[model samples]
Target: MASVAFGYLPILLFLLVALGLSTAFVVLPMIVSRFTGAHQPNPEKLSEYECGFPAFEDSRAQFDVRFYLVAILFIVFDLEAAFLFPWAVSLDSTGWAGWTGMMVFLAELGLGLAYAWKKGALEWE
Candidate 1:
């Protein structure tokens, strides 16, 4: 049992080192900046800068929800590609069952996309 557990020692050590390095990189700069950086704030510096001009309109402009819908649609389809890779790699091992499973998954995705398309989610207007 101890020997089995010891087998993971290198992985554990590598993970610890990776975490330590990542933490040091993130925290060291902030710590150094705390001492070396200037600490002064004014309304001019705090005010929003837009296109090298002062704000003429309300910053919180209402945008169409279609932009977000398009983004979400892209993500849903993009994740389909991610799922395809493992399915393709294990195609032979999984045999007909795997093929059928992937078909069903793809069919579900197709149905969802079709539903979205029908609802004008894909339309710009």
Candidate 2:
């Protein structure tokens, strides 16, 4: 039991250091800014920054379906690109199975892209 607890000492030390650093990073800046008076709030600074003007619609306004579609498509492709790097790195160890699996994944993404293009989801108008 002592050895088991000893094995976790490094992890506990790491967590302590991480907590200390994170707390210092967050609290030190506020303390420095407070003393320097660099974070003074103003009406202009507090106002909305979007569109460089006051918002015309409610903040909870509904967006078009195309907006969501585009966002989802971007996230899907972005994750697919992220997966490629790890798959490529492990390809030698994984051999033919990895290669074929990635090929299939790419093909599926290509087909989805084609389907979306055919449905005019890629069009801005």
Candidate 3:
């Protein structure tokens, strides 16, 4: 109804104000920096900042796939733990159905881990 739509007016106004403030923050800095920022381009300033370490080699270096494999595995296990939190919280209300479902989920994760292990996904070298 008309009254229901009117109820959302405050939220709409708040959204507009939030958008305006965000735009002001982004634009104000750009404007200020454009006018007052210095334009010095010396060799030291242009050089890469590598924790006070001078450039020893090219920056375009290839990383090992072992790092990516470990990272992906960590994310998969991390998400499994994240899903377990809410399931544990409502375990009493969900009864046996919830317990069985969680068991199946864990079994699936175990299988995946086993598969990865068999494929040498967990190996560092």
Candidate 4:
């Protein structure tokens, strides 16, 4: 029981150090800014800046479907890239099975891209 408890000491120490560093990172910047007199709040400073443009229309205005389609496509492909990194890193252990799986995943993404292209989803105008 004593040896088992000791084995977790390193993990506990790591968690403590991580917690300390994270807390410092969050709190230190606010402390430094306050001491440096940069925490002042003014109307212009606190005002919202929408892409450097003033609010010209209703905030609840509906957007084009193409905008959402493009956004979804971007997220899908981004997730595919994220998965590829981990799969590639573990390729040695995963072997032929992993390679075939990744190939199939890529093929499906490619087909989706082709379908989107055919429907002019990639077009901006």
Tens-digit per-residue lDDT, 7-125, candidate 4: 99999999999999999999999999999999999989977786876778997999999999999999999999999999999999999999999999999999999999999999997
Error of 1 at 23 (Å): 7.4
How accurate locally is residue 35 in candidate 4, as Cα lDDT from 0 to 100? Answer: 100
lDDT of 1 by residue, 1-125 (tens): 99999999999999999999999999988888678874346788777776776777786987789998999999999999999999999998999999999999999999999999999999885
User: Which residue pairs show collisions in model 3?
Assistant: none
Query: Residue 82 CA error for candidate 1 (Å)?
Result: 0.4
Error of 1 at 94 (Å): 0.5
* Model 1 lDDT on a 0 to 1 scale: 0.91
Q: Give the Cα error of residue 97 in candidate 2, in Å.
A: 1.0
- TM-scores of the models, in the order given: 0.56, 0.69, 0.60, 0.66
Q: Can you write out model 3's per-residue Cα lDDT over 75-103, one digit (the tens) per residue? A: 99999999999999999999999999999
Q: In model 4, which range of ten residues has the least summed lDDT? A: 46-55
- What lDDT does model 4 reach? 0.97
Task: Report the alpha-carbon TM-score of model 2 versus the true structure.
Answer: 0.69
Candidate 2 lDDT by residue in tens digits, 9-110 = 999999999999999999999999999998999998889887788888998999999999999999999999999999999999999999999999999999
Candidate with the larger TM-score of 1 and 3: 3
| Candidate rank order under lDDT | 4, 2, 3, 1
Runs of candidate 2 exceeding 4 Å displacement: 1-32, 47-53
